[model samples]
Target: MKVKAILIGAIGIILLFGILLTPKLKTVLKTTPSDEFIQLMYDGDVRELTQEQLKQYKDDINQELIKLKHRQSFEKIYLSLGKIASLEEGYEDSNNYLLNVISPGSHTNKMIDLKVYETLAVNYIAMGDIEKGYFYFNEANNVAYQLQDAELVASFYQLFSETLLNYTNHTNFPIYLLGEAVELTNDYYKKIQLRKQLASVYELNGFFDLALTEFIRALDMSVEKGYVDLEIKILGRLSLSYYSNQRYQDSIEVINRYFELSSDDPDLFYVSLWLHNHYYLYGYESVQEQLKSLEEATSNLSIEQKHQLSIFIDFNQVFFLHSDGQYEECERYIRKLEKLKTKTTISELTGLLIDKMKLDLDYDRGDQGIDYIKEYRKLLSDLQLTNDSVERKRLIIDNVLHHLLELGDYETVYQYTADLQKPVTQEITIINSIMNMIQNSSDSHYLAKNNITSMLLKLGSYVLSTLAGVGLTYGAYRYNSYFKMLKRKAKESTIFDPLTKTLTKEALYETLELEIELGQNELYYFLLIDVNDLSSYNESFGYLAGNKVLIEISNLLKIYFPNAYISRHYGQHFIVVIKKPNEEELLQLITSLINEISNNEKISAKRPITCCIGVSKGYLTNTLDIDEQIKLATKKLQISKQRGTGSCTL
Candidate 1:
């Protein structure tokens, strides 16, 4: 019994020693900050880290950030880890480290600055804080501008514009910004990208003329650059834009062009297949042949590619099948997309949303279609995702309008028409009032002359009759002219820039105001801009060039605050009323605008451009009498300029 007890004690002591000294046991009990960090990074790289592991790693690094004397090394490791965290969608951890751990001054490194800003911008975008997202995007652009790297600058604009385009009100702004980017960069590939983005923006804003221009430009650029992938993508956009504009022949032509260009590449070929399917659904004569071709082409693709293609092809197939009265096939395709939706990543959701909507439409379930669209919108809203995808909302709106019109729901249509007619009605009232005043003054003068004639007694009747006849004729002519003017004004106000017909600033402003009024109050803010360099721009660029600059600035303002109210307040000055903007976001926006204007070779290459901005709390009142506010804002803006270039006040 004594021998057995001794053996047990020895075995137990050995086990205890192993627990104390083993590498795994030591790692668990006595892990150094560096060891844990390295391990965390490894786990992240290998995709084995849990949310708790990520949180702990972030905490450890943040603590190390305070104690580390060698900040240069610390920043590198910290940013490196943050990048990994960002990839894993640990946005909170990544943002905390980027925003809090690293010194702002340490962001002097261009690459690091780019990464940090991009990550932060994306995070803010993910959180549905577009104001902050744009702010960081502008920060990223500033860094790229500092580097004098045109490609990077173009890329930043592309990303920023894309984010802005996700919101309906901000769609036009991205197009304008992308145009600026196109002017700045000489690289064919970058130019193609800018054009593609511009096309998407224009399409979203219902600017078919501009959309077509951009799509053609992109196609040309892609051809020039020999980028088949880009060519295919642009072709797809072109087809959609054409389809939206009801240019069915042009849509078919572009889709065919895409099919030809992508014939050699399977991925591109699959895209072509999708385009062909859409073309068929849009009522092209050659759709049957195209469908046959699509099936044959898709058959040769790998299982994964086929599955991916089905995600798009199947959805489109549902539309075509439904149109052809093949309800069973449509249901099958709907089920396929429904199953695919379960496994889709957030990036794929937009496309999936589109597919689901088509399925709903094909099933003869208009209510279901509308419901799906609303759900899709909510998903986008929740994810804070923005891009060309949001343009789908316009289609949904059109669909709803069509359904209402079909059901002879005139009350609903009238309500929509009233909403559409409000701006026109306002303009007409103003113009008619001015015309009435002129007519009344003329009538009074004629009456005074007639009274003088009546004093003569004999010619009184003749004079009165002559005067009445002339007045009636003139009034009739004036009435007709006023109607014509109203029509002209309505068209101009909706489509043309008030200052320059190249674009419509008023339309842009009204759209912004509508967005603010329509959106959830807690989510938006405004930034009122007043330009300081219009005179300089006009003087240097010649009057035409000056007009171009005004157009360019208007376009830039549109891009920078797509979801915000942007308008030409007066001569060489503008106002942007944003939604739910914080102070830091306002500063970032001001800084970006300043940098963009100052760095733009088109505007600033020959002479520098400067702007002073004021940030207000929320959407400005339509009745608030903008004259005094603008003057005050302009005066404050001048003070900021006197202080230095690129200054702003709130």
Candidate 2:
């Protein structure tokens, strides 16, 4: 029996040694130098990969794929990096690979799903399949919502809106989508960004008044967030919007403010562009100084920044030079711009080509300008890009009209107006017909009376038949608007602590409940704060001063946890629930609150203030009532206060 037991023990030891050694042996044999793959990604040098290197990399990736244990997680990182590398490699099959990977049920990570969708949407957009692109963009947005990531949701919406703005069939979609984005995000910076995008969309749609409103909102939010860079950008956009709406004085004021804030930015290209455009509109001479400043600043920019800066500079310079009668210089700049055009993004290229066409027309180079216009049309057709090219088209038509008018070609001008797509020309025709009909009328009073009588007759019957319909329509519209307003108000209130215009106890409770429901699943302490000297302060300094101390404490809470929810439980007591507070953060917050209250000038004679905090940490069970838990914490707090003037008990 002893020999049999010895044999079993020896076999068990051998089996244990084999189990421990197997994985290490396999790892040593199979390991390859992943550094090259990692280096290519980190250095962004995939474009320089040799064909042999690419083949080796593909083979290695295939081998890695076979060996991957965590397929779902591994594929996410692989495909994301692969997509970037594929784009750099200029591979024709890259888009097909991306599309195949973005199929349903392929990715489980919400962030991965968002990236995949975005890649696919961009690819589709580049392919001129806007409808499919938008569908994928919307799918990505839904995933962002499911993930409950407000920042991601806002970003997707911005991209989706911009894409829609570039399409003629769905211009209005962007306006509404941006409005929704602004509503979803609570961060001041993101709100301003969405507002700016919305303002741009509104301006593109010819809703100047609405555009102004959104731009002003963006400016205010930028100021509130203390975002100096964004504030300057918004100011520039505001100035542009005002100029577009013909509010020249407002434009000047806004542009002057932009100059003030953006004086330090090395590349003031946008400012220079705005100045040149507005100068042409209002015939202002001050733009020369701005132009000089811009030229000085452009010397320090990096190549990429210079590339962007030069586009705007050239765009404005084309017209500025023409207006100054430097046609030769303008032609030189146009040629320089054409060389740089190939490196430009699609949007920049479109704007530049259109501007070139306009400059050619302005210089009486009509035949040459028509050639440029044909090129512009081909580019637009090829890219399927659309926007308010109405103004540019109108400028072209106006030049044609003026040229024909000067040559006594009235018949041709009339025919041209009939063929033009400009709303202004259509309005002019309508107004001329109305004027002619009035002039031909034999009795003006009789015509006026007939019009009034006819309008009244139609209005009476229309009102009688549609009064209920109008009321119902108005009721439905107001109801939806009101519902949205209430939802927004509720969200705003949730972030506010009602007692001191900070976070409230109810808000804290709701936040905790949400965290618990979301499976944070961690053990943390809840602190019950009781004001020990509040009664003394109330008696000596009056409740107003006492309230001031409370407000000071609340302000300190805000400083400690700008995103934390704080709540007042009673007249002199507050509560703070932290996920897990370290000794440093908790003690620092308490010390700051006490010091602020004790030293507050509004506290009358620098009244002494003190507080006690009780903390408890354990897995909270459903059996323990919240009020009972608070009472237990308060008892511990009272004991701490007895031990010292300002103390914490745990």
In order, the Cα lDDT scores of the candidates are 0.58, 0.59
Q: Write the residue-wise lDDT of candidate 1 on 450-537 in tens digits.
A: 3221232344343334324432332211122233344455576665555544334556555645654765444434445656657765
Total clashing pairs in model 2: 5
RMSD of each: 33.0, 35.5
Regions of candidate 1 where Cα sits further than 4 Å from its true position? 1-69, 101-118, 137-152, 166-169, 266-317, 324-650
- True lDDT of residue 425, candidate 1: 32
Over 1-650, each residue of candidate 2 has an lDDT whose tens digit, in order, gives 99999999999999999999999888755544343564453333554678677767767766766666765545444554455545454333556655656656675556667766765665565455765665566566455544655556666666655654443224444554577678766677768888888887666655678888888988887898799999988888787677656677777787788888877752454566467566766563566567668678669879888777777777677777767766777788777666655655566435545554554545354332144334443443433334444333333444433443443344443333333223222222322333344445565454454432233244434432332343223221212222333344446556664447755666766667777667676655667777777887689766656776788777776777665556787777777766655757777776676666556665435656667788666554333434555667788887888888667787
> In each prediction, how many residue pairs overlap at the backbone (N, C-alpha, C within less than 3 A)?
16, 5
lDDT of 2 at 68: 68
> Against the true structure, whose lDDT is highest?
2
- Residue 47 in candidate 2, Cα distance off native in Å: 19
